[model samples]
Target: MTRRALGRRYLSAWIGFSAGGRFSQALATVILMFAFGQPTVQALVGSAGTWAVLVTLVVLGGLSLLGQRYRIEWHGVLPLSLLAFVGYCALSVLWSEYSWVALREFAATLGFIGLGLYLALGRDLVQVIRASGDAFRILLVVALGLEVLSGLVLDVPIPGFGIRGDIAYGGPIQGIGGTRNFMGFVAAMALVTFVVEFLTRSVTAWRAVASTALAVIALMLVQSPITGLAMIALAVTALALWALRHAQPRTRPVVNGVLGVFVMVVAVVAVLAHSRILAEIGAAGGSASRLALWSQLRVLIEQHPVQGWGWVGTWPSEPVVPFDVVLAPSGLPFTSALNAFVDAWLQIGLAGMLILLGTAVLAFARAWVTATTFPGVAYVWPAAVLVLLAVTSTAESYLLHGAGLMVFTAVLVIAARRRSWRGRLPR
Candidate 1:
């Protein structure tokens, strides 16, 4: 093949294997399926595939060096973020209530960070973002479709028919906690992509109808109405601020005013909805069980405030399920849990909180700027992340190793790079 053809083939292959590729999504699907007991070995293979993406990035980085033709524009605070994470992990190992467990968490966290860094910094950011976004759209469609079918058709004697906690969420949709919020989060992001693309691309009647239908369908399926509710507020607020700062003076006030109204409305709705959750929480004496277990976390941090828990092991010890109330009776490691932030802070202390905050500010700030420059790039991932931080803080703890942080980091870095490219290219 000619040099041009070789280069084209290489580009295709790179895009195909990157974070957003079909292979990656397939791996994710397989993992979830395995969690549902599709096959132990198959699940393990899927797990290996996740790692393989990380390995590919390392190998790709080496290849780029050999070709001597690669360039990275913005390093994007990743190294500092990763380094701080390492320090926090070390602290956890030293002070962890569950020392051995914390150690495993530490190792797992390190591996996850390593994988994300390889993809975010080394691979082609644009391709990854586009591919990942596309893959997410596909996943949303497939997941929602499966959810409907399983609910309507496969409900009988179906073993592992719903979310088994394999790949974040799968199988039949559990009520509030059973992948409802999780899939809602994914759909919220998809809505953002749809809107952003609609703004830039041709908004044909069919396209508009399809997007409107999908958005409504996702809202219905997610049932966690607040998820989409949050996105609307964030997008309006983020964009209005951006426009005020960067748009022409004549257009600025108008854009800001319109977005301002949109935001105010969203805020009012969110406040009312949040009040309901808080009311329920208060009436029930708070997410106390989660709070109680989480309170031990505070004790752990206070003991090692600077680096409260030892990083390498799970130091703090408590009964796995102290609470009498049962949420998911069948789910293993069941507890009254809500958010990742609380767990991290409890496990790692103020320092860990700072690290997480710093990571978010740096990553989100970059993404915000990018979104501002190319409004088309503005999407729900950032908004979804904001809600994830809030919701997960209330229920679960998986940001470091789970799909949440990985997808969030991958999208933010790629968005930053794409914004940079748009800046350089001639209009």
Candidate 2:
């Protein structure tokens, strides 16, 4: 064989070996754990560690994509709405008031998106879900362990993991997720994953039960009202999915219509009784802080209503125009608007906000439809996760960055693979 041919053969063999099932699973797990533990990393090793982790994932995922080049059918693989939103975010750099910040954030956004795409395209849906399940279990345990050592054993907050030594107080514990709300969010995702794994018989019954118990404990310890509400939404979605999956095909249409109407009515009722509900649930104080922050954001959003300040994924430490206009509870610049939609408007503008809404809504619709029609339990993962994300996003900007953004992109791709129309055309 020619020298070039010999080199190509060796490279192909290496790719095949590296992208094999076991290696892919490990990659997915590491990526997920790294994404979820961003705050812990930032606390321990600072920005250098964060950048190193990102670079490693980018390199690993990029090579995996190259190795699986032919396996991922590239016909309408990505949803158009998603592309429009991300593209707009990138385009914002041109008119961004802080061009440097915008460029840096745009790069970070692509890095995470690439990691997500690798998981969705390089690994099957079941494999990705399983990896997520495994990663969450490990992280949740670590969170609890750290909390125990900090809150109970040492009687002091662990600065690195952000455990506020509140576990002894029955928590509001941060865990490896960096905050109570984040920890709760991770637990909620873990619960969904565990349920699906059980339904699919992918894990033993005892194992599923144990994982579910761990997630529930973490949720309780975190004491986050945002997660409380999300769990409620998750339960409702689970019930709806179960009903639809069990219903006869002929009657499914009627059932779906009725469920849709029911959901609308419930939403209206919830909005109307929000005040009473908040007071009863002890979320009024948190809600008030959020409202004040949003009011501040609204003023900022008004300045450049057409195309707001710009895209900076995380707020800058130094006081800047929009990013530092408001302060976090810690007296530093607030990182997010605490609501994904409002944050989108603040960073990208009304047009970008609308595209983002379209992307999320379209993704949910596709996932919901697939869950209803597909026989496998795996189809429900995307829909259940989207519901959880939507609910939590009402109070926290979890959907915008870190693990949330990565998972969002992955689910979007998985749902689009089967539901998007562009895939029907010749590639």
Candidate 3:
């Protein structure tokens, strides 16, 4: 073969590897569970896991650069908003109370943003979504295997690692993610992905059925209230999108407007009846601490209302900021504000929060419109994930960190492309 032929073949292989190959899938699993020092992987690999994640991200990013076929496209203000958010985070290092910690965390967040951008720009939205689904499938399988071994074979907690048997939790299973809540989150996402694939006819019927069955079983075993509730919200969103997809184009805007109003009303009512909603979910008592934490965080935000405390990635247990000092007195240690919006305000202040929220609202609106107007299931990917993130952000601080943030960025990229495509097509 000629030299040119060999180069082309090598590029093809590299593209395949980074897109949705086994290595990519496995790497994603590691980043989601172990990269940020989840207990089980940390116990097994020590601090090496974090280094491994950094090295892998660098390698994949390098490969993406070499394998690029087209220039990276920028959609509009949405992408700019995201870049501004990251830039603001980096700038926070200068004013941060703990400059060293802020700098370190900023680097980590930047790495994730880079990884997300690489995936979004290097591949089509369908390919990227499929790649993510592939990763979730493999991760769920591995988690189930570990859960079975711990719960049935060993009947004892794994030494050093935090893998606990079903017997220990009485019923709920943690799986390999090291916590029931994390496992539930993964399982919930898996279910959504499988359903989308099935609807799109991207996967064989049997494969879809089997993967979705596994996800449902894992979700049941994990029994996380937050994940369970999030799934319900996703289901409702999916149904609404489906109806809109089937509706006439002229009627969609009206339908969407009414739905928007209804959702806002429901949200207000839920907030007003927050304690009742918590009681319905059996979390009323546990939420007292979260309410208290929110109250303390509000005071701290007032102190630095414009440009709050610097971004710390994850909140430290030792009380790094003024808010942390107040939290320390409660005798109940707090890591996150347990709310993404609150954490954003606490970390980057009001300006950062507005940028983040504005970006999200715009992205979700574009994705929803595209999904409803477009004919394929591919468009539903972004809409579904955005709904999941929005619902979960209320109780978990996953929206702006680690794997969750990465996925959020990728969805934004996809939404931007959809808008660009629509703009170019003849009316």
The candidates, ranked best first by TM-score, are: 2, 3, 1
Q: Which model, 1 or 2, shows the larger TM-score? A: 2
Compared with the true structure, what per-residue lDDT tens digits does model 2 show for residues 1-427?
Answer: 9999999999878778767778889999999998888888788888878888898888888777787787778889988887887888888889987898788778888888888888899898999888988998898888899999998999988776767898888888899888888888889999999999998888899999999999999988888888888888888899899999998999999988998899899899989998899988889998888888998898889988878778776666666676766886667677788898898889888988888888999999999999999998999999999999899888877777778888999999999999989988875
TM-score, model 2 to reference? 0.96
lDDT of 3 by residue, 318-353 (tens): 556564575444576676778888999999999889
- The 0-to-1 C-alpha lDDT of every candidate, in the order given, reads 0.49, 0.87, 0.75
> Can you tell me which runs of candidate 3 are displaced by over 4 Å?
1-40, 69-78, 159-161, 167-170, 317-319, 322-332, 420-427
Which numbered prediction scores highest in TM-score against the true structure?
A: 2
lDDT value, residue 114 of candidate 3: 67
Which residue ranges in model 2 land beyond 4 Å of their true spot?
Answer: 1-13, 328-331
lDDT of 1: 0.49
Q: Name the runs in model 1 displaced over 4 angstroms.
A: 1-69, 74-79, 94-100, 122-126, 157-178, 202-212, 225-229, 238-246, 249-303, 311-332, 335-337, 373-398, 411-427
* Candidate 1 global TM-score: 0.63
